[model samples]
Every structure is written in structure tokens, then in C-alpha cells.
Target: MDGTALLRWGRVCLDDLADRREEINALNVFPIADADTGTNLLATMRAAMAEVRTRGPVDALTTHDVAAAMARGATLGARGNSGIILSQVLRGIADAVRGGPLTALTLRDALRRASVLVRDALSEPIEGTILTVLDCAAASAASCRDASLADVALAAADGAAKALGDTPSQLGVLRAAGVVDAGARGLVVLLDALVSITLGEIPARPEYSPRASVAAQPVEDSGETGSAEPRFEVMYLLADTDADRIARLRARLAELGDSVVVVGDGEGRWSAHVHCADAGAAVEAGLAAGELSGIRIESFAQHGREMASGHPLAPVDSAGKLDGPADRGVLAVACGDDAAELFEEAGAVVLAGDDGVTAAELLAAIRAMPNREVLVLPNGALPAHDLVAVGVAARDAHRDVLLLPSASMVQGLAALAVHDRGRIAVDDAFAMSEAAATTRWGSLRAAGERALTMVGTCEVGDGLGLVGHEVVVIDHDVRAAGRTLLDRMLAFGGELVTLLMGAAARDGLAGELVAHIGESFPGVEVTVYSGGQHGDLVQIGVE
Candidate 1:
């Protein structure tokens, strides 16, 4: 297939996975229970798709160039362990077929190469991960040696689906949880999408609503007891050219923590994930290994509690019963005091969010509301597991919560601006979600440290301009970055622009941006507000 076809495949795969993200996320019990394999995979896939779009469909792009860009894009955008491994797999496939036509043989080799490459990236390849599903798919393709690419894809998808079913047999944790491996499930989903695309049709899969599958107090836990597991889970991307140094770093991290999996190549880029008592020390090891960025530290203890609960960590109001007829309202997770007030004034019950948000925090908001039908705007990006758990919990509370997947505060604002209280809950949710999605958003933030991003290496204090989670530009001046970001977002055309400046944003920055907006996009209306948020300089929304 050509670049455009590959881009189409990527987008289709990403969309299919997005629709089932929560279902896949619920199956995450193994691999440390961060509960975001689906989220990570989707994020990485989106990055790869974005890269292809950037190359342009009509551009005179070679297959090799398209492959290389997608692989590199996924590598930079990789999130959790699943994401990192998935990136390596895509890179491997690209490496195998970049130089030639994608015949059945090439497709077979690509699958084989992807499986092997991902295995090498891991310090210890697990038997029941997406890796196994990948290998199974490759083997299935081999069994159909002389088949067409479409036939091979179909076989691969079928094999992966069967392998996913057997994941519980390979991993005791999955067996205990009474579900297949979450990562494996996601891999199968992608493969099935590949089958659909190769056959030139997005097949309609049977509708399946997911319910929590974890049985409380599994048999495997009967006599199993342990000291407190690692207090923190730390992950980051490090850039180092020396293989020997990366090896030593792995050993050092293993000594400091448990469930350590540091993976990558000698090509100067690696991702390390570990559970440890001292998060600072884990990060320090990465610093010694190379320049590190995209640091994420989460409380394993907190995650464990949420997971063990098999429900919301904290239930909303006591007795869990709504006393009367169901009403409808809006719930928005706000990052700052001012933002929260704005949402509240807009008739939305505000929940505190950003890095500190938890499932309980979201549940609390749902419980606080007397309305039975609630439209929830998570407002900020959260790990898939947390969001899914909150959503499930909200449903359990007998509230019909329609979660509008707002990845940014600005998106949440757009949804709020269009929210119609007079409409039925489902109708309002439909309208609000559409507005939130149509609104293209960007943010300006200062880099936390020297790190490798999609744009390039960004030093501490460098301005990072992002569209969604992808960093599109890096500059020394935040205003310049903001201007560039605005221009990029406005490229598709917009009638309204919303600017929310954080607490540390310079007072005149908005004025400067507003002036530029007026000059560049004459008739577009601009609305500015003090978001009072930290970490980010400014957030922009376009509609």
C-alpha cells in the first residue's frame, strides 16, 4: 500500500481502539496494574497517524519515508510499557518492509520482525503479553505462505484473537483476574482492524458492553501475602547512545526497584519503567544514564487500592440510592480555582483535576450532584484506567453519566459553552461532545528538563507548543510558541478563539496574542481569562 493507504489504516486502527479503550483498560491486572495499556496504545497510534497526516497524503512520499516517520512518531509519543513495546513493534515492521513492495512475504517478514524487535527491546520478554499475540499472528501468516496480503492479514487477526484468549493460561495473574491480558487484547484489536482495512471494509463488530471482570478475592490470593509493594511507579524516556551505559542503568534500576523493565535500542533512545520506594532515586538513575524527559510518577499504593476495590475507591453519597426522579446536569473537572468557578457559573459542578485527580475525586463530584443524568467532562487528560474506573463507578451509583472525553481544559470550555440544559441528558451530551471534539486546542508550557520530544530535544524552561499531547514546536519565547501554536490551530479555520492563561503567565501575554489574532484572523472573536493553573503558561481553544 502507499502512504495514503497506510495513513488510512492507522486512523482506522486508532479509531477502533478508541471505541474500546475502556473495555481493554478494565482487563489490566498484570504488568503492575497501572491500568492504561489501551490508553497508551491509542496515544501512540494517534501520534503515528498525526505524523502521516503531517507528511500529507498527496506528497511524493516513499514507503520507506512513511514507515520511518510513523515508527519515529510512535517512539516519541509512546506512553506506558504497552506503548513502548508497541512502538518497537511498529518500528520493526517499518524496518522490514520500508525498502520493498508489501507482498505476502514482506507482510509475513514484517510481522516476524516486529515480534522479534519488541522482544529484544524488553529486558525479559513475557510470554503472555502483546508480544505473544504478535508472534502468534506472525506464525499464522507463515502457515499461509502463498496467500494474498488480505488473506494473510485475516489469518493474522484470527490468530491474534485466539492467542488473546489463551493469555490467561500463559499468565497466572490474568487467570486469577479471570480475564485475558489487557495488552494482548489491545494487540488483537489492532490486528483485527488491520484485517478490516486490508479487506477494504471497516467491519461491523458485534456490540459488546463491558462490565468489571475482576472477581473480588481471587483464589490465587488465598494464602499469598507480601510486604508493601513499591510505593511509586516511575517511568521516563531517556536518550543515550551507549548500549553499555543503558545496560548498567538497567542493572542499577533493578537494584533500586521491582518490576523493572527498561527497553530500547543502542540508537540513543530508551524508555524505563520501574516500581520503587524512592521515585527520586529512580529518576536520578535515569539522569545518570542520559538526558531524561516525559517523567511520570504515580502512586502504586493508590493504584492498588483502586484496583482492589474493584469499584470506585470512594463511593459517592452513602446508601448509594437516588431518592427520586432522575434529573440531568453537567460535571466538569477543572484545573484551577478560576477555571472551576467559570464552570460552576456555567452551571457545571466542578471537580478538582489535573495531575492530582483520582477516581475518587471524580466520583465525589458525581455523588455530590443530585442529578441522575450527568454529563462529565474530565477536563484534563488522565490515564485510561483511572478514567474508566471512574466511569464505571459513576454508572454503579445509578447515575447515567455520559463522559465527554475532554483531553484539555479548553475543550471542556468549548463543551460547556455549547451545553444546553434544556435538552435531555443524552441529547445534551451528544451536542456537547461534538463541540468539544470539533474544537482544536493547543497549550504552551515550559519544559521541565532536557528531554526528547516529537519536535526535538527541549531544554529546561524552553517553551513547548502542543496540539493535543503532541509537541508541535519548541521555542525560547512562550509568546512566539503561542503565536505559532495559534497559527497552526487556525490553519483549518476557526470563528472563535479562547485563551486561558495560567497563574504564571505574563500579564500582557494575552494582549499580545489577542492583537496577533485580530491581525491574522480578522473576524475571529477572542475571549481571554485567567485560568490560574500551574505548570502551563497558556491554553488555547478554537471553534
Candidate 2:
């Protein structure tokens, strides 16, 4: 319940998971024939562990803090379908704990809520998966009247183990494969660890033998890998809050994909997942439902080692260091002429996005790079598919790439300004992302449509002050609107202002803003340059 106990539980669970990972991976079948359930679960648990360790010192954290941190880490780093569901389930449990003392009643209630959350996250629930295993465990715990926490945990573990063994009889696919549900096996392992820790006993090591041995992919009649399921799996976090709107989104996504899942806090934030032939359409549905971020799209055929489209990790030598060639560089997507110049000046191979950019163009850009390991800054200025394509292409060529999510020119510029060519790629990426994060960027654009935005309705040609992807301010005058936006941004206590003037911007407007900034907010330096962006009269950034 507290931080110390939570840490102990985590160590036991993670160690058990690591030892049993391959066994779990071998048992994967239901939903899709992807043998990555173990990897996904491990990654999610690692993320949770890292979060707890990173939040200052472990000794000072409380039960509430650690629980919240684990949930947050799991939600952000969750991979694939099973991982996503597991994350929300952890979140549900965290919510139930909420800094309270860990007791039998609390544990029982948390387990019950975890199953409910997992069920809610799925569009169509199956009878014999990890969900069923967790529900059975929770039921066993709830039935124990006035039992100690240790006794309850042991009972839960026993129930989960039984349910896991019974999975083949409950699911036809699992029976056909002659294997138990991979995820259910993982849940049993976790509960077993919990029981061991609660009882202060050394956990029994699990045997790695699997009854059936086979790869995850299904083959077609032509002897190539194929599936009758959806071609692509798309996922992202959506921010909005209308119960009716969420219901609408659920219906729409169900129409678009079979494995549709839209679940999170009912308030305003939710994680959306769908598998469909059209990735773009699924994303558009989310956009119509709410604002979206952290977008990931994967080809079902190339499940890759992770089931999600992850690049193969760089090889580590006998010294346990990432072995790489000396030749390394940064490949940046430049949306404008000035942006290209800025990136080039910083030793990046710039791909100009003057016209529309495509996946093929991105691949060609990667091929053009002379470095073996390249830091990619797609800038989030182009379509998501293009960037994902470049990542896949880079992986195929065995080039190490670290893609930065620089969504605006200002963010890209911030990153470029901080990048050190001689430093390690990952370290430089962290520094650059930190620099980008410290700087808040926005644009002044004229609305072309009359629609209900998160900020409210906007008429045609209305001056829109945008921060990140959402419009935060609407006004009639461009110059005054820009100043108003600056006022709001400066209110957050920025040290300097960076302006990227558009072609449509007036000659003296940048100077005028600089002068105003100097007066309105003394000691705040202002710098400006022509951005040559396709739209938006002025782009602004604060650092």
C-alpha cells in the first residue's frame, strides 16, 4: 500500500515476469496470432518501475504517489492491445487505492474494479482471456470474509492459476492452438509473485515448457503471412468530454474497426485504439470526437518482434554498450525554406517539405543520409504515416534512428539550437526534447470554417491563436490577437520570445511586437525571422 511495500511488490513481479516472459510469449493466440504478449507486459511493467524510481527518492514517496506514478507510466508506455488493456486496469486499481491503507477489503475492491475497467476498455469482450482470469481472482478474494491481506492474496493467486489452466476449454482458438491464453498465463505469474511477497516466501520458479510451439503469424494459401483481421492497428490519446460524444465515437469506431477500444477517464481524456483497413479514417473519427496525440499506426502484416512497429534495438557488445559506427547525424524534416536553413546550419540533413511530403520521400531522405545512426526530427509537420514509414525504412536498412516529436517550427528550432553533434545521440535527443519542452509554440491563423472547437465556435476568417494543436484564443484583429496571445504566454513567465514571421505578415509587425514586448514585459528578449510557412500569418514561441 505504501511506497516501500509497492516497491517490494514491483521487484517481485518484474523478476518473475522476466523469468517467465518467453513462456508467456509462446502461448499467444487469441485476438491475433502475435507472440508479443510477454514483451508488451514487460515493457509496461518496466515503464511503471521507471516512473516510481524517477519520482525523486523512493523512500519519500507515499502509497498514493507511487500508485499514481505507476498508472501514469503504464498508460503512456503501454504497447499493443493487451498492454493497453492492462494499463487501464492498473489505473483502475490505482484509483481504488488512492493513497489509502492497503487492506483485504481495499485489495478485493481494487481487483474487482480492475476487471471492470478492462472490460470497459474492450469493444467486444471474450470469455477466456486475461480478463476472465483477473475476474475469477477478484471473485475469490471478495468471497473471503474478514480474511487477512496475505490470505486473500494467496486465494487470489490460486484462483487466477486455476482460471489460466481452464482458458483452453473456454476459448476455441486457444484449444485449437493447444495452448493456454498467453495473457492469462502472465496474470497468473503476477498473482503468484504477489502471493509470495505477501507471505514472505521465496517464489517458485516457473518451468519454460510450452505444450505447443509455433510462430505468431498466420499464413495465406500463397505461403505468405496474412490475416483476415484488420490490416492496420491505430492508437492515440483523445482529449474531450461529452458522454454523448464519446458514445458517438464508440459507434463510429466500431463501424471502422472490429477491435475498437475507447476508454479512459470519462471526464475529458481517453485512450483510443482500433484495428482497421483505413488508419486515417480511424484517426479522423478521434479528431471529430476530440483532440488526439501520441498517435501510433502499425501494419498488421509486419508485426515485427514487438507486435507493434518497433525498430530492432541496436546491438550491445560484450561490454554491454550500444555498439555503433562513428558515422552518425541528424535527419530533420524542414517545413519551410528558413526552417531548412536553420536545420542545415546545425549539421542536419534537411528534407524540404515545401510541397506535400510523402512516405517515399521520407525513405529517400533517410537513404540520402551518410550516417549509420541518425536522429530523426519529422517535426510532426507532415502526415503520421510518412514519419512511421521513414522509421520502418530506417530499420530495414539497419540505421539507428531516434525520432523527436517536434510538432512546430519553434520546437524544431529549439531542439536544433540545443543539439550537440559530438554528443551521444540519445543524450542529445533528451537535451533537445527538454529544450523543445521549455519552449511553448503557437500560431496566428485565420479560420476557414465555422465549427464548434474545444475553445468554442469560430467564424470564417476569425483570427485563431493556436498552441500546440488546439485553438486557445479567437479574435478579429491579427496584430491585437498576436499581442493577446503573447500576453497569455508571457503570463507563464518566459525569458525570451521567438517569432517566425509568415509571408503574409507585415514588414514591421515583428519589430512592433519586439518593441511592445520590450515595454510590456521588460528584460524579455525578442527575436524574429521569416518562416515561409504555407499558412498562418505569424508563429510565436516562448522560452
* Highest TM-score scorer: 2
With a 3 Å backbone cut-off (N, CA, C), the pairs that clash in candidate 1 are none
Worst 10 residues of 2 by lDDT: 219-228
Q: Give the C-alpha lDDT of model 1.
A: 0.74
Q: After superposing candidate 1 on the true structure, give the runs of residues whose Cα lies further than 4 Å from its correct spot.
A: 56-58, 201-228, 265-267, 303-543
- Taking all chains together, each candidate's TM-score versus the true structure is 0.53, 0.58
Give the least accurate 10-residue stretch of model 1, judged by summed lDDT: 218-227
Clashes of 2: 0
Candidate 1 residues 287-357, lDDT tens each?
Answer: 66775667777775645533543533223235333333236788888888998888888888887764567
Q: Per-residue alpha-carbon lDDT of model 2 for 1-543, expressed as tens digits?
A: 576887788788789789888888887765666678898888878887887878888888887677777777777667777777767666766777775856788788878988888887776677788889989999998898789988888888888878888887887777767778888888777777777878876445345345534444452222111223577777777664576777788788778776666776423467777777666567666666765677787776655533243545556567544566446788887767876887788778888886766665766677778776777777765666446534643553346667777777788888888877555567678898888788898888877889777889889878888887888888877677777888888888988789988877777878877887988899998888778777777878899
